[model samples]
Target: MHCFKEKICLIQIATDKEAHLIDPFEIKAAPFFIRVLESSDVMTVFHGADFDIRTLDREYQARVKNLFDTEIACRFLGVRERGLGALLKKHFNVDANKKFQAFQCGCQ
Candidate 1:
């Protein structure tokens, strides 16, 4: 459960070198898929994960283990703006505009 539209849609997997966008709608779930997500070894990271986590359970019927969310981190740090865009600008000095957060996805 990486990227989604309505249900789980595009799953983005990244390594040190590259990233892959997997279309879950096209691929049937592999046997170890849930195991992979719930595994204790790899950490699942998300920013503002409320919808994403809920979608994974409600839509994909899976639960994630070892979850880390930047929004939660921001809250832990006592930041007023816990949004990804705001955190990025404050901590990393990256200015990712907030206009696209509400924009519709999976459309031209």
Candidate 2:
């Protein structure tokens, strides 16, 4: 299934000082958070934003403002590998969990 068809089980947000994982299923303040996404002052950054932006609009009717897509930036910067997992590993020495790798990008 495409990303639009997939349920957003979690929403991950990271800052310079902290990271947070929010379970959409468990949250009562989802509307409040959606408002935050729609705010022009809050710049929301995404690795590969095409699907994420579409999904947000489809699911929450939230239109994100002031978006900075890093994958596009990497492309313009001429980074050979543009995938999030690859970039994270190359730049941060972090190994992303592979358990969900097989399920990504509408792979059967």
Candidate 3:
């Protein structure tokens, strides 16, 4: 989850157990989540953010105030990159190998 300006973006990577319990109703009723959506300065998330925004809108009637796409950021940065792993390797000097790189793909 991240907030920027008045927008809030939440990323939920569910494990097998947690994934099973996931439901639209529970997502809406989660009190803490509602609070985050209601009160945030800004939100920045990457690819497929629309899906998340749609789900939040459908379940809780929440609306994002401001949004920044990290994938777009990488492009604007002119690093000739697309995925998080490559960007991380370029900017953060992290050695994200093929195995871990594949795992990082789901982040966006």
Report the lDDT of model 3 for residue 79: 54
TM-scores, one per candidate = 0.70, 0.85, 0.44
Model 1 lDDT per residue over 39-76, tens place: 88978888888888788787657788988887788788
lDDT of 2 by residue, 5-86 (tens): 5666678988789999897877887888899899898889998999888888888998999999999999999998999989
Error of 3 at 85 (Å): 1.3
What lDDT, from 0 to 1, does candidate 2 have? 0.84
- Give the number of the best model, judged by TM-score: 2
Give residue 56's error in model 2 in angstroms: 0.6
lDDT of 3: 0.55
User: For model 1, where is the 10-residue window of minimal lDDT?
Assistant: 1-10
What pairs collide in candidate 3?
4-42, 5-41, 5-42, 6-41, 6-42, 7-41, 7-42, 7-43
RMSD (Å) of each candidate, 1 decimal: 4.8, 3.7, 10.9
Error of 2 at 87 (Å): 0.6
Highest lDDT against the true fold, candidate: 2
Order candidates by TM-score, high to low.
2, 1, 3
lDDT of each: 0.73, 0.84, 0.55
